[model samples]
Target chain A: MTAPIRKLRVATTSLAGCFGCHMSFLDIDERILKLVELVEFDRSPITDIKQCGPCDLGLIEGGVCNAENVHVLREFRKQCKILVALGACAVNGGLPAQRNRLDLRDILEEVYVTEDGLARGSKIPNDPELPLLLDKVRPIHEVVRIDYFLPGCPPPADAIWKFLTDLIAGRTPVLGHGLLHYD
Target chain B: MKTSNSEVSAQANARGARAKAARPAEANNVFTIDGREIPFEPGQTVMQAALTAGVFVPHLCYHPEFRPHGSCKLCTMKVNGRPTTSCTLPAAPGMEVENNTTEINDKRRLLIQMLLVEGNHFCPSCEKSGNCKLQALGYALGVMSPHFTLFYPVRPVDASHPEMLLDFNRCILCELCIRASAEVDKKNVFALSGRGLKKHLIVNAESGRLADTDFAPTDKAAEVCPVGVILRKRRGFAVPIGKRTYDLKPINEQADRFKPLTPLPKEEF
Candidate 1:
């Protein structure tokens, strides 16, 4: 007969988020079994891989707040055919962008200098190992062309499930009002 | 009195004629909103008619009780191939209005984006996250993000009142508060100042504080804000998440079909 159906390669990552989106992904619960049957994980948190490979879909779960985040997002955009911004953070910079009002230097001073419980000479970290922070937190789409957006703090597990199933079925995944929540 | 069948029929007809004459006559001028024919009364605006007919024309500043402000042009619709704000436009018979169109929605989305960028809409941390009309309209229109650059304008929060707090940072310059205070509460405590992008809400007190004015916690102005600008102190998030009005259902579903057209709860949190 014809060639057997191939499992779609999927990858996921967190940038400047609290990893709540990944936790929501896990909240998919028993449906994960069905998800695994239809798709193969590649360079995801579950796989612990260092880099993303050629994949059919990529779930980006945070806004870009650093040089490393930009690099990783561009890589995902390059490797994946469809990129989905997975939470409020990835969609609109969420709560992290609140700091956009304050000066970056002022923010650093508030955290590293004004705050107590550090070495007497505690200053802003400048280690080469650490990723450099951006002037402001920006949503993922501002940095790359995002194909879809799931808008929630961490989009409800069922919403994520519906998105995945709808995409797999070759239908345009339009989020309804019941499924879309900004909070 | 003994009556024949013919006489009884005549009496019944006369009584029916009297009852019909006693009733108040309503002039119904029907208009079409997105191809659906909606019957409107003589004095109703297009927005009022559409809302009465269970059709949503996403609005912000146009509250039903107050005169149509027409400040926020989010309800812009094609009335007979000409664009007009439905809130201010009077409904007329045989008028064709296109509301739910791609062109108008795109413009509406841009207006929303402009509003978002102009204000500090921190929905996750703001008290009006679920209950805010502006936020609900954003969701209803499928605005996943504020697609413009963030302005991050510095605005002050007036917490002078013991019972009320005015977070000016979230004000969209809707003037709902101004209308409520002047027309309903009769306090004349609130007003708008400046113009263009600099337009802002102001209190009538010399000290520029709400406590110095005659505004009380029970004033109609206190409950009229569609956004998080006017809020009661210490009552933030009184209703838990997922149980709020807009949280459970979208803004369109919550719109009612009859009088007392204020869909958002008045005193109830």
Candidate 2:
């Protein structure tokens, strides 16, 4: 008889993403049953765990758009052996980086102060609790080292499944043909 | 007159010879792409010949109907130990072309990533997400990350025209529209201005807007764009995601062996 196999510990988080990646992750559907047998969740939305423990794989979605994102990403990087940037946002700043051309102050003022529908005395918010926004939205790799990147708007559930299965089987994850898409 | 059996057989053979002369002659010249020998005619570029043979060379600005621009350089391959644009290179005998190699494909991947970061290719929100050549190429080449700083240039979207929109931010500077306008449509409604990094597409009207020109939906320039530069008024996501052209299969697999060689003259209307 051979030795028992240990489940691979995986952690995941969303920064500036729409949580579509996570939804797609859950979109793995009944494969989640098969996935659970091979991997255990840590600091994931599925577990509702806030703090990340030492993990085998870290799946991070979204770009680093603010101070809190950098802090969280750096911390997550330290605990995982391999870190994967998930989806288009984390790959290249995706849709959120569209605002990189405009000044953050101008965007805030336009939305909060000068818009036609805004109230008379409205101004940009400045609370101690709010995380300060960065001048330019950046991909996660600009802040920390990312081992692998999964591309797609929200990588198709099948793409994510293929990525995970390839990694689990000691293979360099290669998303090919129908499995790879940037949108 | 009564005909002998030998005379009738000879007449049938002569009739078949005349019919063969009427059809366009098939390509007999041969060149190798990635060690796979394919046929090419004398006038055809390597890309045209490759596509005609159902092979893909990973091009952006190349459309079969239009003349080869060779600007994108995505089709660069080692033609007998020298890197040459397959779109502009002529087919010759015993030409050893190496495409799909690890060295060449890595360069293609880098070229794509450079294009991706050089422009603001916001694929998720862009109307040409699934259908865009740039997006399809990014996936085709395994560009995991852009690996470069974003330009995020503040380019104007010319919605002055009532029927169409021109988003300059996504322009890869592929001059397909410029060629289609001047050569095919004979309209001279579009031109490129400036040099190097500052080079950009501009309308050929006095107001520098598309509305001031005689441009219409029927023009070939309106439909020759490989990216999201030229778009119609309101039908952005008409074909739902996961069902678009490149979504179902990669661009390499979609090359048609029986596709007509004529440039599409009426796709605009």
Query: Interface RMSD, all models, one decimal each?
Result: 19.0, 19.0
Candidate 1 ranges beyond 4 A from true positions: A1-4, B1-28, B257-269
Q: State the displacement of the C-alpha of residue B107, model 1, in Å, after optimal TM-score superposition.
A: 3.1
lDDT of 1 at B257: 22
TM-scores for every predicted model:
0.86, 0.87
- Candidate 2 residue-wise lDDT, A21-62, digit = tens: 999999999999888888999998889999999999999999
Give residue B103's error in model 2 in angstroms: 1.6
Candidate 2: pairs in clash: none
TM-score of chain A of each: 0.95, 0.96
Candidate 1 per-residue lDDT, tens place, A1-183, comes to 122299889999999899999999999999898888889999889899989999999999989999999999999999999999999888778778877778899999989988979679989999999999999998887888988888788899988998888788786676777677777
lDDT of 1 at A132: 93
**Per-residue lDDT of candidate 1, residues B1-269 (tens digit):** 00010111323433443444343322446766665677887667888888888887788987777778888999898786788998888788767677776677778878998998788887777888888988888877777677676776778789889999999989999888998999888889998899888888899999999889989989999888999999998889799877877878787666572232544223211
